[model samples]
Target: MSDQRSVTRSDLVAYCDAMLESSAFQDYCPNGLQVEGRNQVRRLITGVTASQALVDAAIEQGADMLLVHHGYFWKGEAAPLTGIKKKRLKALLENDISLLAYHLPLDVHAEVGNNVQLARLLGWQIRGGLEPANPRSVGLHGELETAQSGAEVAASLERALGRMPLHIAGNDRPIKRIAWCTGAAQGYIEKAIALGMDAFVTGEISEPTVHSARENRIHFFAAGHHATERYGVQALGERLAAHFGIEHRFVDIDNPV
Candidate 1:
């Protein structure tokens, strides 16, 4: 057991660092405490990815800290803080709210990962990674307990994610083996195809993905990225609430994409 009352900023960082294993991933930005704030924290808010809308919502709700899957200062982005990035940071700094981000680590956690949670929701038994070469590969391959048509699986996905998935069935195949990677991983279609998956699911779609799906003869489903990513943040928030006895809220900004 651990004490949960009156924790300091350092304590919170240490807690998140341990939970997310921040040191392991080659993250684009600093994983923990990108922007410092008050020494003590009592309330925690979590969102899928750090966006302007999410930051605004956290500030409006008077959150002491905000945790996200995506944070500021990503690699390949302009180093200068002069545009939208500047405004976001300025708002966070002025409000004195701490920003913490965890990317790949959040996607791979057994209990709280996006793929794991999706599988739990859809009753899929996970087998292994879609990419055999990469252990940290976020895409997962699994099978339904029973057989289902491509349309039926799409309906299940829509119900679980609260958005009707964009379905592209290639070969009228009955789906049993499935591969999924949440959040704009349409590019992984080839990986899923190589794994001989009957269906592949991801958060967003690309123009080339349509062609890939047709050419490779694998069912491709584009569920909303924001919708798919909601679970991990909620799980992480619940974990924090249980661990630290703090007020935890998951603010959902409904994104249609």
Candidate 2:
């Protein structure tokens, strides 16, 4: 049990913005404080996406703040708050719950980001970035502690992620070096191939990824985007709770994809 305490919304947003350097990345959506509700946050709920189910669950839990990876208002999405969007926004507003979102910043953070967290969970020694030139590259290249076959890698992913990945078998060779970027980064497989990685793992697979993996002789794994990205937000929530002595709960709404 932990002592109960409350943190102001402004302070929480400032801490996250500073820690994640939200302004550094040109993200698809705004980084922090999408919907403001309460000033004092005592109970916080963290999730992968700010979907309707998640919002309802947060409201049920009586959370003062809902912190998530996916938030509203994307670059090309319709500006009008209609249908599902309207309902979601309405729930938060009616309940007076603040919504905080961190997108690319949460993916690239050196310690608490999704990529590094996944690496830590799977026991991969991170070597460098997929795009070595880009300081804010979201993908990472690393090596396994020991060489293992493509099947072995898949099995490890299944064990760690709780979902079997869709494996595109490239070659029969063992996988020692690999690269990974979570959440729809299947396009970066080429970067992995160029980096001489034996295997590449990402959230979603495209039509051409199969051909590319087969032609390039590198194993490819399309792990579930939701499963792979569940860690960073939880890690951030834990950090916040420990730092501020506020109650934190991670509500996981199952999503197969």
Candidate 3:
């Protein structure tokens, strides 16, 4: 069992922050060390969100620290902790389990970022960032090894993510050039359209996205937010575990959206 291995909370946080370059990204939420818990971590738990369910799972697993892609204290949120936030923080504090979270940093990290990991998972090679100007752009454009129909692309996404994706066919052309970003990036379809991608994929599809896709004649796919973001955190957890020689487990909270 890896329980015998342990890592100091400071060391773990430092390693992650350095590896992810957390300070570089302008993010909605604060990255790294969201909640303080135990000083020494032996078992680490990772998940997509630091929800109440995930917190409970970490506690149940006897995790010394919890790492996640989504954490608390988003910009413009209420400064005072109350209700669900209070309850979740209380649980972590009482159990002495530290909470570590990364938002845009994890999403944009080159090696373990969600976009890159998704590409690796789907067997597509990235051609370039969706936004050519921004070196650290969140959305990316690429082509599948072989051209496939829009339905075939949706089927491939469903198979990879274990959830059905909503595919909006704007064109009948086989998908060759594709652009994608994970988690509620439907608005980026405009960029994809501007780039003349055959299709665009993201976690959520907004109302305007449908019309934009149809009008622009570019296909759109809304894969699950949770499903697409799963790989990066898991990859981060596995890396941390290997580096620190600690036991790591990824707890799934079954978010279908």
Candidate 4:
């Protein structure tokens, strides 16, 4: 049960940065406290992305702050805040809703992270990071307790994620060992290949990724990006709310990608 208490915005952000170790990551975007609003956060809303729909939902829910896995101000995007970005920021600013976002930090966290949560969801026993050389690797390698056919794994992913994964059968081997990174980490397929993983699962796939998996003879599953990542922010939000004794609600804005 939640504690049903309130916490100040500063304390909440500070605690999250400490718990998630946001400072440690050289993230593409800012990790914590993206947009500041109310001083005290009584009701917290969490979501996959800080999209306009999420902002509206947070406002409707009377959220003091909106916490999400994906936030604005990415590395290569246009810096100027105009068009949809401007509108979204305007809504949050007008409603006095704080925005907190976590990226790589949330994905690699020990607990309540996207990768860990996905493992739990799929009942995969984690072995270690996909890239053992990198201590802070975002993707993880693991095993399915029992080796199963590629189709079986695809079915499991579809059942859990509510989206049919695009399965690319690279080898004729029954899959036991696998690696997965949630949300647009197709580039890490090479890491999975290097680790000799039987299969690789991730959100979003590129044309090159298909060729890589086929040539490398490793099964690849392209699960929906939004679907694979829905859990981390919710888990983090619930824990944060419980720790601070505050009300927390997760608003999922449906996105096919």
Over 140-254, each residue of candidate 1 has an lDDT whose tens digit, in order, gives 9999999899999999998888889999888787999999998888998999998889999999999899889988888999998888888887898888888877888898877
lDDT of 1 at 256: 91
lDDT against the true structure, per candidate, is 0.86, 0.96, 0.93, 0.94
**Best-first order by lDDT:** 2, 4, 3, 1
The residue pairs in collision within model 2 are none
Choose the strongest candidate by TM-score. Answer: 2
Compute each candidate's TM-score over C-alphas.
0.93, 0.98, 0.98, 0.97
Name every residue pair that clashes in candidate 4.
5-245
Which residue runs does candidate 2 get wrong by more than 4 Å? Answer: 1-3
Candidate 3: residue pairs that collide: none
**Residue 20 local lDDT, model 3:** 89
Q: Give the TM-score of candidate 1.
A: 0.93
lDDT of 3 at 37: 93
**Candidate 3 lDDT, tens digit per residue, 135-189?**
8899999999999999999999989999989999998999999999999899999
lDDT per residue, candidate 4, 14-116, as tens digits?
9999999999999899899999999988899999999899999999999999999999999999989899999999999999999999999999998999999
Prediction 3 global C-alpha lDDT: 0.93
Model 3 regions more than 4 Å off = 1-3
